[model samples]
Target: MKDNAPVFDALDLDRHAFFFDFDGTLAEFTDDPADVALDARLGLDLMRLLRRTGGAVAILTGRHRAEILSHIDPAIPVAGLHGAEFPGEVLAHDPARRAQFSPLLPGLSALVAAFPGTLLEEKDAGFALHWRRAPQHEQAMIAAAERALTELGPDWVIQHGKFVAELRQSGGDKGSALRRFMAEPPFAGRLPVAFGDDLNDMPMLAAARELGGLAVAMGERDLPADHRLSGPRALAEWLERGLA
Candidate 1:
């Protein structure tokens, strides 16, 4: 993590809403996703601070709500499944997208099974094949996934991340989730601040910036962020400052 001050002012805290990406932004990344954990005391402090400031906070993550919920305090609002699902809101996207792509899964499964080293993760609307444990074939698997996605057509979008490649419905992303949140109560009419790390978080960072808010990029790997911090500890420290 870098120790540079982000170009943000304390005055912007008034009536602000905060949205955060889970994995890298809120917790340290782990080889096994299940190993990620939150700092319970810090999380409580931040949540309390946001509530006291008349601001709302939410988590926008690529993981399933259940997976994310297991890592963070349950009280926070969450948009999960990469915006495919929201808290208490039925998914607006068509479930049939998965069905349409079902035919391709067999081939994908066969390919992965033969690889012997990759880990296959199946979601309701997408699939992610992780090659973190099998560095030798990471690039090959990514290329295969890309080709499969291209052959599968525009309905499917292939997203690449650290040691993983995912195929999901093209329309659902963190930007969509943030936009949807901004349109609703508790989140609307407030400064929109988002913190994230990774290429997948680029849209949310852009959205926050476009909305006249601050976008803080977390971790060492860079994309585009209004402010860049080294890791979650720095983020927690920044939040403790209250923009004041």
Candidate 2:
């Protein structure tokens, strides 16, 4: 994340709804995603923003609700695994889906073993093959993911990102999550302002624009973003300043 000013000017952020992506947009990236943590200062600022927004702020993350709750307090609304609300149940838990996914797990695990530089991020609903530290192995990782997807059939899809390939449940995307939030309590009836940094967040960005709102890109990557923030530190500062 680099230092850049937000592009959307003169907009009253407090008056609109806010949705955030945690990994790259809010938290600093770590080699292991599990090692990522929210800065307490930002956490407090987030609490303030939540209050400022009339409880319309939400986190739409790939990580499960349990993981998010451990890091962020005040239990803000969240949608984990695409659009599934937290503490409810992830669609990946469906017995039939699990049965279909089980056959491909061994192959993916083998790929992880072969690519020591790559990491296998197992989730309750899906899995991700991360090669952030091993960018050179991108091609190899994609090939492995392809093989698994081919075997797993149409129920799975791969989300490509910076140094990573995520195999997830088909049709479960950020756009769906954002739409779900917009149709629900608090989030409903407000202009959605989303912030994110990767391919996974693109859908939500597009969705925000569609819903007559805005999308703030975390860094300078290609996406349907209306504004840009320098980095996670900048986001924290923006929120902290709002406390005044």
Candidate 3:
């Protein structure tokens, strides 16, 4: 196990730009993603601080932009579909090259349907079959998705999350999204910091730390984070004080 430094001090907040993962970083994980709720006061406070400091804040998630927006204010910048779509910005990478990947979706749907206990979730740019409820079939579901996606060739990418397998249009990931944001105006001069707590978030965590900024991991399972918080409440408390 890697030893993470202490939670960031409030004084360090002024110099950093915060990038967060919504699902497990800001809200507790639930069996159904739809049931996760945002801390309204926390969201409002963070937004206000970002505006006041002229620091940029964005969400980099596997979820579609619209889905993320539905749960929070749409005004917040979001990199969705793992950077396949960033509103107002020309896609840093093209999705057309990955069109052939769609044909595999039906097969994926069929596989999930036959699995009996898995939940097939379709997103704007990709599909995910979650097996959190069907732990017994988790390995089989992943193996099936891997085999199917592997057959699709190198252009398609498979992202594995907590009990979920995602097949998305390729050419970018959370790392690319973070880099793209760093090249833009508001986020350009600021130091990039990110928060997340899942396998999918590893790239963003690495990206932030690579740029000499903070990467915070939430929850009990330690991966890599410059700082660690117990869970969403601890994260919120840290942010509230940091932004204060």
Candidate 4:
């Protein structure tokens, strides 16, 4: 959260489509994921941005769409489970994919059970093992994710975040989601502006730049971006400036 990143100019609401990452970008990190909350003021700001941009705002998150809704307004469009879930698009491989993951659940549960502070989060395409409450178990969680990947075969991969490791299907990511969103109404024909704070967000950031738009890095992840801000507070202030 160092303030080393310079502030950039306000976005032109009419021409730019905004894509945001939730945790570590819009909201601060929490020991317990269930305790994470979206700031009411930021939610209102997002609603205003949506209005100003002709609804060109969306969230691309690792959380499930339903789970994300518990924190934010359901009116805002969200591509959840790292884009595995989209608005009204039923994935043909969903059931098959879920079945593949079902068998691994018992083993994963047993793994976390050995680590008192670790938690398992099941998602549409896969699952995540969080070690935030038990940093000492980080390596074990990662190894577990790697082992799960082997069992799931080439179609699956491991995604490492701040204090968590996830095992999910390969291909469906924030970048793909961004590209898909850019092809649709309200998002099409506009420059993409992505904001993120971690390794998992690199694809989305790269996509924004590849699409001839801005990539804003939040926090100190050393991410390649056109602009950067310290963290969520800085982002909130930056959004306020854009609104002004």
Candidate 3 whole-model C-alpha lDDT, 0 to 1: 0.77
lDDT of 2 by residue, 88-173 (tens): 55444567766776777787788888878788887766678998778888899999888878877887898887777877778778
Superposition error at 81 for model 4 (Å): 1.2
Candidate with the larger lDDT of 2 and 4 = 4
Clash pairs (backbone) in predicted model 4: none
What's the TM-score of each model vs. the native?
Answer: 0.87, 0.91, 0.86, 0.93
> Would you list the C-alpha lDDT of every candidate in the order shown?
0.79, 0.80, 0.77, 0.88
Best by lDDT: 4
Model 2 misplaced stretches (Cα beyond 4 Å)? 1-9, 85-92
Measured with C-alpha atoms, the lDDT of residue 186 in candidate 4 is: 96
Give per-residue CA lDDT, model 4, range 59-111, as digits (tens). Answer: 99998887788887887899988898898876456798899889999989999
Q: Please give, for residues 110-135, the per-residue lDDT of candidate 1 as tens digits.
A: 88788867877788777888887778
RMSD of each: 2.6, 2.3, 2.9, 1.8
* Model 4 bad stretches (over 4 Å): 1-10, 91-93
lDDT for 227 (candidate 3): 80
In model 3, which runs have C-alpha deviations exceeding 4 angstroms? Answer: 1-14, 90-99
Per-candidate clashes come to 2, 1, 0, 0
